[model samples]
Target chain A: MNDTLMTDESRLRREHHKGHYDRETVYRILDENPFCHLAFVQQGQPVVIPTMQWRVGDMVYWHGSSKSRIAHGSDSAKVCLTASRIDGLVLARSAFEHTVNFESVVVIGEAQRFEDTAQKTALLESFFDHLFPGRWDALRAMTASELKATAVMGLPLHSASAKIRRGPPNEPEEDRATPVWGGVLPIAMQFGKPLPDEFNQMPEPGYLARLRTKP
Target chain B: MNDTLMTDESRLRREHHKGHYDRETVYRILDENPFCHLAFVQQGQPVVIPTMQWRVGDMVYWHGSSKSRIAHGSDSAKVCLTASRIDGLVLARSAFEHTVNFESVVVIGEAQRFEDTAQKTALLESFFDHLFPGRWDALRAMTASELKATAVMGLPLHSASAKIRRGPPNEPEEDRATPVWGGVLPIAMQFGKPLPDEFNQMPEPGYLARLRTKP
Candidate 1:
């Protein structure tokens, strides 16, 4: 992997200090977040859609109904995929200095539809495995029509960047002495007790029982 | 206040039943999520920016560095703003039926720069108040250059929609009897312990000490 990735177009244009293009940082944030907002231009205007997305190595993939115009619009198009997780709320002394601690990644690439059913099935299984380990094998195999209705597009993570922020708020020397509470309030994703399906009559998989994400 | 909002441009083309155009649902989702992905066409290709944004009434606001090109790009142009909160992970009996329960809002409109100093100042304070309540007044005031360096843009929510999914996974009868565990793992965002600044010498505010999001 390259030390950094900065194309004429991928370079961070604002707050450059907070910008990072390292492949490791980019890949880590991508893998950690399963949801991403896909941005693509249509008829001179841009649209954003939150969808299920995953990354394998450097290639990113998204799935949707092939019959849907909006979801299928991503097939062979210039798109920007972005995923972000808010780490904490950075409470600076001054309102102007207040910011959020976050890790974000952006990948700009052209995505093409995967016409090969075998490849889509394999990727779909991976998606299940990633989200629900030790359970994919037990589920029934997918039907051809199910595969036909789904559209999977792959975008190589060629041009990407990650912006990460951590630690306490950046309070200037003068404001530090002020009698105001200033610090970082950590925000985390916690999984609660699982609610079984109405007809589910089987024992919980060990992995599903341990599906909680450590905040 | 009406029953539903359906615009030729803003309507959900797929999963039509999941689409909601009611102003109440749209407003509620907007107020609940402070972070939004702003999508707009930048030189033909779309760019998705993870930004701090909030909606007040029908107006949506975003903050950024005024000097930067991408941040300033929203001065006056068509844009799509989207915010989403994941409610739970739907573990389904079938791998193909897996989904995430979430609530998302999308608004399509044109964004204009808030150039007036007074208006910008008020909005900036609102940002702080929304993120950290009972703390804005304790901080020091901003200088003119600080105000000049920041960019605030407002977009009116003219055409919008909210997509919400809740409850457990949609398991059909045939898949329900299978001997595989399937359920809904509720996900939540919780605020962790506050990490004080190195120089902070004041007691934490009531809001910060008991920081929690009611999921």
Candidate 2:
């Protein structure tokens, strides 16, 4: 992992030493989160784009419109990306001590735009398949013009770092005497009843079955 | 509701639309999400920070280290924040068409640092009550040094926009003739069993109880 991407901001410091960096830990966190906030500077100002992302080994891929202003110039510009998931809320005794337990990955690198049609198509296929195992095979082939209108960019994960904080809050030895109630108020994501599209003729996909059954 | 915030992004171009400025729809999505990616430019370079956030009325408060490098000029910095939640994964007949249904809020604003002690204390209290109710009174008060060392910033929700995409993929009518299977692979977030802190000596809070029983 690149040490440059790691910075110690006093307020959000790595607590419990669990929020440190390592390539293995970083990759796992990145894989778990499907969407990432891709940030870059445009016209000397900060711009953030929310998009779906897929990881292949040590590289991350994201697609954009051919006319996207930022996407067109990403090949030469510096980029910073952040992906996160709040697993639980750490409700400690003191209001000042309260914090949310989360896992987040940050990647800093220069993006390389993929220009080859075959390579872009392959990457796009993997991006879809990574989220839905067999969905890519169900669509019609991309037309030449359609292919020309889409762009894909790849950024290596070597300069990435993972920061995570889990469990309870950090209470001072002096404040431990307080009689306030304290414990973890875990956060969770739930899928509501599926609303099928007007055009969908069949039931949900099999992969969804596997996901729902997962503990 | 600011009409200027509703600019025409190519993906979410809604022309001559009214009632798109309600705060409930905008704030609900903002308050529901626990984490946000904050992007800013430092020395002509892009930087991203993932931090916990709370929405109170029309303002969002986020706190971090007073000594951190990212917030070096936050008082005068133009920041862009993006918050998102992935609801479900769309499994299309073709891999290229598979997509994820999601809700996102994007804000571009000038961050104003809160140096006043009273305002900072109030913001911190809101942050406390939002994270956990009835607990702020239970904990000890913050020390003068602690309050001084921490930096609190507020960005009004005036300049913001929310975007969402749901349901199944939109395929060409002619593609139905092809023999590819297509459906949605639903995605969801579900709460797991609460893991109490190893050092906890008191009972769990009531807020957590509701979280455990809710859908």
Candidate 3:
């Protein structure tokens, strides 16, 4: 595999030192974050929709209602899919130097709809397994009609790049001696206690234990 | 104020019940979330960039490097700004019924740049006060050159809609008897303990106490 996945559109113009084109860096960001914002041109106007996304090998997939405008507009259309995670808030002595520590990946490609029912079913199963291993087999099987009502689309990672910022704030040389309190306040997404549905009769499964231990 | 702010493009087609066009609901979502994704068309290609956003009255503002591609492409151009927060993960007996509990606001409008220095300065100060009250004054003043290097843009909330989903998953009646464990896993963004810079000699400010007590 190539060391970098750089394309004309994926190149970073500003703060170029933070730009990363390695597959490992890009895939790591995609895998760590389950949510993404998908951008596509609709009716000659730009539209963006937030959706849950997962990766399978070199392709990233997201599902939506078959009848959704997102499904119709993105089918076989060029798109920009971005996954971002805010790691922390960097506070400097000066507001000008204050910034957020984050990891983000931008992938540009043409979205391809998966029309094969069997393939779609397997992919959906993997989505569940990716988030919660062993939970998919424990649940009821997906109905044929249910599969037909969902649209699954995938975008290859051919043109992908990652941008990351981390650590303490970068203070200006002259302001380094300022007495102002400055540092990093970490930000994280955490899972609270799981509340069982009112109708649920089963005890919590083992797969859910991971959520409690996850950082 | 009008009861709703619905335009042809802002109306939701599928799951119309989840759509909210009222200003109160729309404004609440924008105010609660500090980050947003801005989408715009650049040379006929759709592009999405994640940035920090703040809402002041009927307008939402974001800043970026003046020389960045996002600034150049979105200047006086139609753009879509979306602020989303995932409340929880809804789990159902069947994968088909799985969904996320979230509050999202999508605002479509032309991004207008703020060229006046005084106006930009006030807006930038408000941005800090909105996120961390009284912290702006504690920090060093922003330099003239720094202000010139940044671009501040605002979009009116004229064409805005909020979509919210909450509570347990809606499972089919027939599948209610399934023995699979199902429920909602709550998700929240939290602030960790503040880590002061290595060179800092000042104690933490009172403004940071709010972060510790905030939910």
Candidate 4:
């Protein structure tokens, strides 16, 4: 079972237009994407880093080196977590009118570093399983030292917002008559055939067929 | 003619990794996606915002209010820009081993706001045309005062990094022996029929067909 459920909100404002507080849309996007961009400052300089992340309910978690410049010595802080999925390319007759349809989430809140052993262990398990299910359980549990060395942080979706733009171009009236190519270039993410890691010993049957039946 | 070119070494480093740096691969992902996540700090806290962006050669530009919290009063000076594409979902025989294949870029650098009249005018033209070509030239130019009110910023592709995880699950030797299902769930982005703005009067062919040719 995954903890990445979305919290519900009924009164989403217009500016916050696509801000979905619903679990269905939120979890669907979160689960389909594995990486997220995190922004924070170090010594007054803004820096953005890309890292693997897992979502638990409305909260997101990620890890980095404790000695890293951005997280190591900073005071308690709030940072932004964003996940976006690009749907298509919007080409207009005029070069100036291109646009794209997309879905994205912006989370603004404080991130709390996980220090306790029990919580860290649980989070690690949740994260690993979230990334590669059952792998965590099959592997040896994290030793006390490994847990101590890793830095894990969690940020809640307090000021969370999501934006999505879809469909075609909104060209001006008369300009539509201009002779130019216009339309969407649909794009997709497709999976290549799976290759087993070198360390794997067993000659197993393909797993691709299995994934379809389960989800 | 596109302004978003990636040439800075640092930006390239931050964006290109061993398995993900091929130009054809990078550009394929870049041209197809429309939205990016901007990470910055406000009042000692990190805030991530989702916004529309365009790539023109090496530089990526984003626009917003001059008095906005994340941009106008940003403390770190530099900002982090990230874009990610989720290719497919992985479902392994074991529930704990699910994963996804993805491509992503993390950009780190200082953002210089556009203030010069000439630069602002050019940038605005690029911005407008980048989103909707020919529209800038066709529409009335922004008055001096109107230009003064808009804020634009440029972040070089310096100190960037790109990390990508692709292909299928690396199932454990033991799990491979299990009969449970496993495989990938592909994700794609496609454009729907274009919708003209209610206010748009003269309907030319519209911009949908032109965008369809994008990779």
Which candidate leads the pack in TM-score? Answer: 3
Candidate 1 C-alpha lDDT tens digits along B76-138: 488888998888888887766878899999888777888899999999888777766767788
Docking quality level of the chain pair in candidate 4: acceptable
Cα displacement (angstroms), candidate 1, residue A137, comes to 1.0
Interface RMSD of each: 1.3, 3.1, 1.3, 6.4
Q: Go through the candidates in order and give each one's C-alpha lDDT.
A: 0.80, 0.69, 0.86, 0.60
lDDT of 4 by residue, B1-215 (tens): 32333434324322134344444555555555546677776667676766655666666677765555445766656677767666676645554455556776666677878788898778767765654555555554456765665677777654555557666676666766554444555654444445544344444443445554444
Can you tell me which runs of candidate 2 are displaced by over 4 Å? A1-21, A73-76, A190-205, A213-215, B1-4, B7-24, B73-76, B177-181, B199-201, B212-215
**Model 3 clash pairs?**
none
lDDT of 2 at A195: 57
Number of the top candidate by DockQ?
Answer: 3
DockQ of each: 0.77, 0.47, 0.77, 0.25
Of candidate 1 chain A, the 10-residue stretch with the lowest lDDT total is A67-76
List, residue by residue over A1-215, the lDDT tens digit for candidate 1. Answer: 55676776789876789898888888888888887898877666678888877888778888888886534554238888999888888888777788888888888877778979999998887777777776778888888988998888878877888888888887668888878887888888778888887777877677756667443
On lDDT, the leading prediction is: 3
Q: What tens digits encode model 2's per-residue C-alpha lDDT throughout A1-215?
A: 45343444212343436554566777777777767888986545566767767888778888877777547643246887777777777766666677777888777777888999999899988876765577566667887777887878878875666777876778876666688665566666655545555556665666556556543
Give the lowest summed-lDDT range of ten residues in model 2 chain B.
B10-19
Tell me which of candidates 2 and 4 scores higher on lDDT.
Answer: 2
